[model samples]
Target: MDDLTAPTGREEALRAMPHPDGTAPRALVLGATGYLGGRLVPRLLGGGYSVRVLARDAQRVAAFDWGSRVDVVEGDATDEAAMGEAVRDVDVLYYLVHSMGAGKGFEAADRAAATTVAAAAAAASVGRIVYLGGLHPDGVPLSPHLRSRVEVGRILLDSGVPTLVLQAGVVIGSGSASFEMVRHLTEVLPYMPAPKWVRNRIQPIAVRDVLHYLLGAARVSADISQAVDIGGPDVLRYGQMMNGYALEAGLRQRAIAALPVLTPRLASHWVNLVTPIPRRVAMPLVESLQNECIVKDSAIDALIPPPEGGRTPYRTAVGLALRRAEVDEIETSWQDADVLGVPSDPLPNDPEWAGQVVFTDVRTAHTSASQESLWRVIQGIGGERGWYSNPLLWAIRGWMDKLVGGVGLRRGRRHRDRLLVGDAVDFWRVEAIEPGSLLRLRAEMRVPGKAWLELRARPDADGSRYDQRAVFFPLGLAGRLYWLAVLPFHGFIFAGMARSITAAAEAADAQAGTG
Candidate 1:
């Protein structure tokens, strides 16, 4: 992913679409915390538009690097007072939110949110409303998910305010849910048994091109208030999409068996078992896949020119998506912005995981090792250095993770010496890092619930103190049972890990003194 704060040399060009008062037009993004909205906000800022975001959690928005750059109005869209005030001073509003994972009455929830935005935008006299909706066939009976999207688009257009709705199919990118789905399913299944929807044809768009068109839409005429389709050059069947990912990942082609009896519900459960996607999110996505979605015309080009050379082809997009994994760096992931009980949150030394049953195993060791040596060992915990514990157990765990389509331990670190907050270390994602003090790693392996490992080093009277803790939050009965199953291995894995790490630090410090 391109740096969100970098200037694209087109800031001055946006001056042509200036506000009525001769200022840089301010754009208010409704779903600023979402995947598409999070990406769009920084580009809007880079393109010379003053941006504001409506966020339910202001602190979450503030955590982003570009958070301080944009104005934040903390509120939900369904709240009438908040929506009215949020749209008041904005010239353009981007509606990138929908009720995808909301269980029952999701259609009602989406309709209500869209209705609120339409009314608020019209009442505030916002310049233009831009929305991103799914691309579906014309006269077919749409699924509840696709039907709700179409209804939301109609709500925006019927409002007195001019709206431009960009309809796109499966978006292909490093962190995109669709791309992740394709990647995991292809990697895990050599011989696939899929639902009949795997044969459906769809036009997948690259995330960069999606951003390009969204940025260009800001400059389009207010008269263009209709929904336009945007997508990549080549259209392929869903099975072909999976094979495309397999090709980019340098894996052999998969043999697919499309079974007619497998329903969307069953397919979602299968997806949950294989990929990181939760069943709720997968259900709607699977249902929508039943339709064949493709660009019917070249209408988007007349308003917004093709991205530089042209739109990315399907295979090329897959390659771009795979490049991040190859380098062990995914800027954002579907997990970061997906369904419930996501394990991305920090450990509960405080109240981060309050009211939940948190199981923990704590270990401490005092060693005749310099603080610097201890810090180095803690920082280099994963990757090629290994976990400083039983090799067979670690290997077995990694193999199990790979079998279930998890990232596994093969995705080493970005650097051998240094560490960053977002860097990937084997099957763990670096959650927090304090120089010479602390490192917290969140588990990315497929588990029933959330898990984290924390390591800390501090200066003692003569040497150093090393502290290690393993924390887990159970989801349900299954999550609790999983914790019990692994509890016995704590002696072999966690305790030995702590003792080995301290011993290694002592050895390193002794060697340094001799040198």
Candidate 2:
């Protein structure tokens, strides 16, 4: 190759310009508490870069699994002083923060934060700045969220510092709002209606591949200071994506019909009612799908090379996500417990149902059986062992769930007598389990709200105490109605189940004594 086409020594050498004193290149990550940032920190650390994060609450950052491994600067991103403090002595700056809300003015908020960080990075003379932006078709009207993301990329690129903006579409992974929408919508509705955007072409990328490009961006050639589009190997319609997820999740291929009149607002409300994702997060995600979002060129491959085995195929990505969701032990990792559509702090208590409304039923029973027996009965509560209630009632509910395309009772248990953090038993996923004290199951059945069942076994002076609770967090008026309509059966189902459990334990004790 000619000298002009050949790579320069400077390009080949890892320039520690930001830390010319020979120390490791320092990376400053904003939005460390957000989804992508939380995943990227460890990747950067593993890539041999020292990591620092600027968070409004240092404790929240510390709460992550990789928290203690890096330095945390407590500050808000919009504050100039705070941004400046965070940018000081940083080599590469990563901007992964963005906001999506149901209300107005989020655009202005995003613009301001981006401007502040860009100015800070420029002033600090950081080696390079890396920004994660959304992929959108050019010259087309964009959703407010996508528009703001593109604007933020412009702000960072124009900051007088070399910037590598990696634009990605619909990141597929657990905990991603986009992926969660797909997961819940497919799991809840077998026949999806309306939304012409469902047919728009979308190039979805996996989270692992996104992180690969992001990590490479920290050292992308200083000469490249433009946005590079990245995506998976295949481009599929939004409907195709949903059905792909269904195939991996072992559900029937979803039948989706595009209704011309279904607007994003109305669609989001429908999503809220049918899925665990609330309207607030679902609205922006739905709107972003209104236009085609695909990679524009091969520029990204030139700069960051495809992930190790090449970019993940859409179906392969879906399968990996389903498998990963089964057993991620880290509290902040991608294992999406079906408790909520996506992760947000649990709604705080308030008098009104304006936002959060939780309904619960409690039943207790006392018996002359040891706690061990009671726990054995409690832990083995579902799938063939039975729900400890009327078998007819359990079968009816299971059929009802199956009719709505929910997981139903068919999944059963992974082990006859063993339960783990993410094991699935019938229509419930084991959320939490304490050896002999409590077994909590999160409902995966199609419902208007979130639901959980707790079976507790405690030792009493005489023998053992068995307590059972059914908790439901209603989504809206529909969710409220769902709870009310089913309230009458609680006495027969829940109360009897609690009593039956303790009785069975006592029967075991009596039978053992007879032996």
Candidate 3:
């Protein structure tokens, strides 16, 4: 092996030149909208790197707080021309793109994309290419997803670029795919008839620690270029990870009965039937669980030292992730990924169809309270503070949703009294919010139709007028039937909700007046 410090080909000039600031290196992140990539940008910026992100659609990351702080170039990595444009003049290129959940032929797609990215980086004279890949045991058949990850790393390394591959197991963090699987499985099932793969050893690392390693990768001596395995201090079975999550969530210890007869296909279907994860995404994850993913080398520790306090324990990581969820401080979510083959449209209220059946129940009420006071009560709608009206009915609805594999009410608001464009509120996601005027929530519960709840407040002659609307776009006869079935509840739930919000606002106004 040759020292990575000796630059070869086009990288010679790039390595010799210093950044304009003569401080930190310039980095370009490929998948800025992804769970890990989204989190990595902030850490890189905080580390004083001039960060640039390349995304297929820049709008996907427009809501990120650091969006304005970094340079964004919109392009797809699979396109040679786009890749060339995105990889230009960067000291380090982070390749975080993967095609795991994209249905059939994802492996080939990943290979093609990696080839294009590597060729473009080599052409653009990128000094180093940092890639994050999955850790799998050798001498065994690898799952399609993990195999694709490894292939991508190989492609980058063979491109004559100084590529540093960091292979990791399950990443524990809020809104991560693996962590969500553990969370949903533990929270929903008390007695799980799991497959034999549940006993496979896995070393899960905290997302915070992953970010630390990524930041450290930028400053590592250029003489090191090889694959490094990273993991937390503890190595536990997949089943134990679930048990640890349950403990952190304050749930009772679960009973796991390992059944050898259950295959990966059956396990995927079971996961689809129980958790919010769909069949497509769960299938690959279930398939990959059969391989042991524990770390075999500690070479990464020599390059990037561990966090000051130390590696986070599994239980502590779970608790921290849950705390972020409780406080509505999550920066990104698995739902943010467009790989689920679901609609990514932010607002579904387009009225372009001339002939379509749209059902809506709109109600309005006038209150003596000011707009500001009412807005406060409207934003604080879900979570521990149950729905303002018909608490029993809401609980029954949530229970029914849970029975049908929907998100239910367990995913409470990320904040107690604030709403953002992508924030999850119970079974609804906040679609839009205007400070003193409007808040719209889109339904995420399993339904035969698209639904939204829009609330608006405006200044009236005397005080303020509150308008509430429940809009549903039915799919077919089944959707119509579903709407008709829930029609009775709407009258009771929506009507009472309008009155409740008004009363609360009026009470607040009165209290303010007295004060």
Candidate 4:
């Protein structure tokens, strides 16, 4: 090549580029609230980068504990104006948006979004564009999902923007849709009869390791605009992955019998039946399984060396995912509102109908206060009494639940003087009541899973310690959604319930002393 057309000293230029001294480099992460983006944002912040997020819901973006370290803007990636704003004055732009929501024209939507992002990055003169794509088997008929992932990468590459594309297959993590689907199916089903795609080879990556690569890619030289395939150390077929998951999750031994009659279209429905992933998301994933997802090269390993202990194995990944699931079982419940449909009025509170367990504790203290006086204070729990604490948050949740066709706090108590089975108690229903000793109520709100409320007054060393507890057990995919979505407010509501019960008991004692 002639000197005039020769490549410049890109390496020297990168070396000469300014560093952020003690401060972190500013990064703009589009779709920062998504599954991959969500995981990536925290790691970037930990690496000392001032991160910015662009998402549709400002509330959802704010919900993340990015704290004061990150900035969030509500913007759509496909819109030119919004995309330009999101990419402006950023060291690196992470394109993590994927249009997998099953509408009629998702493919076109996916291409348009990519094109818009690429054009926006080029126009804004962003330093580099980092994208994650899917690995597809060459020389084979590609499914629409895999084809669109590849097409999205091409759209960015053709835009003349320096792009670092990392192609990967299944990502194993606690909340990851793909990982959850695999976990639920393996745990719930004993013997497996799956589609022909069960034999297809796949390379799964741990979510932590995937986050590692993404963070490393952001700080690398802007000139390293190459498509790198990333995978875990192990390469196994879908059947093997299922076997490992079953073993890790403590399920009985399972055997897969591949059948020719099962197609991708049929497999999606089957996955929907067994896993928490809905048909809208399951269909695309099932279709992509038809193509082999084995990594073509180990270039990413060389770029960002694996940890000193070596990369996590597929079995280890399954173990970690299951452990996370167990840890997250409490504090939230998963339930999909769409799947449960609209709850009917006068819903039954039977344990068989609700699928919940109730625990109660009752104790008597040697106090001068009469039982009648104490019961009066307990009966008046909602409305003016307010929750034990965090009244504003409880009101907000009750309002939201009411808007969603649930029995909100407006119900109050059926009869404050007495309680019985199936009697309404504010937003709760009396599932069972043992006179003044114990009371159990089932939640009558729209939730991902079954929920319950229990009240018991027991004597303590000082006086009587009233114990009020709320418990939730999830149903399926929807149930998990319900739990995750509501967990943040749990501490506030639960603490309030405890304080209110204690205060109510004290007030009753004071009233009895006055009488």
Candidate 5:
């Protein structure tokens, strides 16, 4: 049994691990931009492993706080040549890539991706492969999503590489797909008319506990090549899990009635109507609830000791997730992935004039405050702190968006004071951010047209020049009419907003100077 943690010294670990050049035990994370992968890189770094991340868009991954710490390789997992380059000089490969949210044929895509990465790891002679997979009970029929996870795990194990697969049920955490589904359902509905599958039992695991197991796997001996089942201390039905969340969220007890006629397809539609999660991601998740996912085997307990405080109870996990959401401290969100209909690149500067119409309201102001102070005020715009202009108008608009199945203002910003490229701020996603210079946001509200708001600040002799612009590309007559209707309000909102932001920045600067 080769000791996974024998080389405790950072310098010694580099030499001991199989690396082309002598460095630390290099760990290459394939899906570093995803929810779990985003959190895992920082932990691996803390555990003394040199980390490198591979992403399709390096700029997207670069927005993460830990991005600067790890070496980033820009490439897609499906590309063999890119995988070969990424796999080289790596001791452990964390295969966290999946395509469940990628619409149809994702199962085939997932299988192909797993095979490609497994072959790459074997070719690179990687010492170990660590994978996080979904839990499915044996002898029970698995959903397409769960089956794909199982197949991927099998592919890695059979690749002649020592693979440690950790199979977990619904991961309870802020921004996790499973937890968000639970959070939205519990928060929005007082009486849930759910499918009969709500009765199915599940063993949910806290994200913290799951991260612990992932990190622990890296320290285990290479002799351990089997799959491990991980779960929280509580085994509960899906409905009961929702009840637990409700209690932790301080919401009144929700009444859930299971309807046999309500199929998974129908339930997914219902989820889409009530939650921010789209139907494509919701359908596969709803389908998987039909099968019981409680952990049957607990063999991993001996291999990796539980965290110091022990496994998180289901209720405790829900509370922690809710707290993180309340404080807007979420590290990663399922929304961090690409939204299907939104533009992948930044909004175009010039409008398409092929019989298309765009309305723009651009305003500029000169503020006698530093660029840093203005940016600080601009970045803190959306959450509990109201938008600087008209609080009542913003509230009314959010309520209307919520009525139309939009995220509204409740999703809030990830952090109160800081703005990240992918962070959700109210109903707008932070599309781009240039520190102390510019911030652009794309509207997620249910609208008849595409819209954006851009803010720019630059240092000037007096202080700084602040500019704000609102751009809308109307789809048709309805979009044009909608813009016309909102034009008067924009004049009021945009003007007042500029004045308010400048005032706030100057006040803060005055207080700082006096103090």
Candidate 6:
């Protein structure tokens, strides 16, 4: 999963192609489990191409919801025998594989895979090869990551198959490594101090628009064979992207000071320290930032006109990404739980589940800190206790909820020091209650989706451990859109909530000692 965003140019390319429905034009997608390839497969299928996917883990490919409509072939893209078999009888081949993140000698591995695919495509007489690569100025010194991308394109072209290369910059969408980096950094840091490349110009495209262009490519005049640069309408610096993301999130102004001393290697390690993202993914992303990645030729635009519906603005793309994240959060099925490595049993101890929708946060802190003690603190949560911190924001959100058919803070809890399952506490309903260990709440207000707050605690070696989870089940597409739109804000609020709960628990323990 490298790039998650789809270029509008790819959609334009697909739309320009005639439908393969009746004749069932055979198409094969290598690396179908990867981010971009994950999206490209469905788009290709929807465009009426008979899609076959080649993946190292065929089970993962089979797990996708694309249904029985597509064929799943188990094979490593780099394997010559596998590549040959996968490309057999295919009319169009999409080379979406990359050797990065396989540890050292990734370039050599990438070159090998490209050569294998190209040779197989040529051998099979595959008519076209659509490849996605990076957008870097030709003839300039390239980063290892970008260099590998360009060389891969050359390998495919040299095989004598008519190749359509689509080179792109940053792609903005959920699950995209690049987009995730930006989203996490901008949302977590109140202000950012970055490397000098933050000032470098670049263009960003949306995943949806990219899907559109990929579908368009299938029908594009078979004669057009040159590389095309795909991008969104806006050209901005990396710094500007940070600022724009901040504004859209309704977050405070993100101040960034570009430092001369921070190199990409150092920055990648810094990224690992600040984010859950691994260093391998961050290094290539950061190194590429040293160059300006704005689109150069309008040749692609001229070849694939906006009238065919492939152009989208940067802001719109970002907005779509946020909304899509929210929607995905709500509609996320139990199948995703397997991928997330969540325990199958809902009551699994020491487990956590997270959900987000809009810009509000609600968490039920669970601990071995006795139900009475926990309820005491929860009942007195507002007013003088001040909600641990950020009472103002809590008050505002509560008021908003109240204005739209919610009890808000005014109702407080009944029987301030005790609670039972199914009992109503202010605007929250106790969905589950296990004395001394767990608490769960179901919201009674109008929201983007069905929402809940849950807490589970068990004794730890020291004293006790706590786990909190917010859950949302989206109603439809709108509900999903709502969850992603507020995902980052949820991260901030949750962080504060965790700190507050820990502090309060410690204080309560201290008070018991004194008494």
Go through the candidates in order and give each one's C-alpha lDDT: 0.82, 0.76, 0.80, 0.66, 0.81, 0.66
Candidates 2 and 4 compared: the better one by TM-score is 2
For model 2, residues 1-515, the per-residue Cα lDDT tens digits are 21111123322233333455657888999877666777778767756688899976564565456878998888766899988889988889998877665257778888999989988898999889999998999998998889999999999999999999898989887656677678888998889895999889999998777877787787777888999898998999999999999989989998999999999988877775565455565677788889998888898867876655567788887776666556532223222222223232332334554555689898888889999989988887786788877788887887777554454564456446766555567777766678899887877777998788888999898998988888789888999999999998888899889888999999988888899
lDDT of 6 by residue, 404-456 (tens): 43445543442334554434444565655665666776665457666776665
- Expressed as tens digits, the lDDT of each residue in 1-515 for candidate 1 is 44122235433344336657778888999877677887888778867789889977676677566889988887777889989888977888999888777778888988999999999999999999989999999999998999999999999999989889999999988767798789889999999999999999999998877887788888888788999999999899999999888888889999999999999888987886676565666888898899899999999989987866577888887887677666645555554442432235566565655777889999999988988899999998877889999988997888677565565675556456777665567778777888899998888777988899999999998898999999888889999999999899989999999899999999998898899
Decide which is better by lDDT, 1 or 2: 1
Backbone clash pairs for candidate 3 read: 328-414
After TM-score superposition, the amount by which residue 73's alpha carbon in candidate 5 deviates from its true location, in angstroms, is 0.1
TM-score of 1: 0.79
For model 5, the superposed segments whose C-alpha errors exceed 4 Å read 1-23, 220-224, 250-252, 323-328, 339-343, 347-360, 368-370, 386-409, 442-451, 460-463, 471-496, 503-515
CA lDDT, candidate 6, residue 277: 43
Residue 74 alpha-carbon offset, candidate 2, angstroms: 1.2
Candidate 3 residue-wise lDDT, 309-401, digit = tens: 677788888888888776667767665654533334554545653487888899899999999998988888888876788989998888677
Q: Where's the lowest-lDDT run of ten residues in candidate 3?
A: 1-10
- Which regions of candidate 3 deviate over 4 angstroms? 1-24, 55-60, 74-85, 99-116, 158-160, 174-177, 180-192, 221-225, 242-255, 268-283, 322-339, 346-357, 386-408, 445-451, 472-489, 510-515
TM-score versus the correct structure, for each prediction: 0.79, 0.66, 0.81, 0.63, 0.82, 0.62
lDDT, ranked from best to worst: 1, 5, 3, 2, 6, 4
Measured on C-alpha atoms, candidate 2 has an lDDT of 0.76
Q: Tell me the lDDT of model 3 at 17.
A: 34
At residue 208, candidate 6 shows an lDDT of 62
After superposition, which runs of candidate 6 have C-alpha atoms over 4 Å from their true positions? 1-21, 307-310, 329-515
Estimate the overall C-alpha local distance difference test score of candidate 3.
0.80
User: Which digits, one per residue and each the tens of the lDDT, describe model 4 over residues 91-171?
Assistant: 788887776644467788888889888888888888878888887778888888788989998898777777788898888
Q: What RMSD does each model have against the real structure?
A: 4.9, 8.8, 6.5, 14.9, 5.2, 15.8
Give the per-residue Cα lDDT of candidate 4 at 426.
55
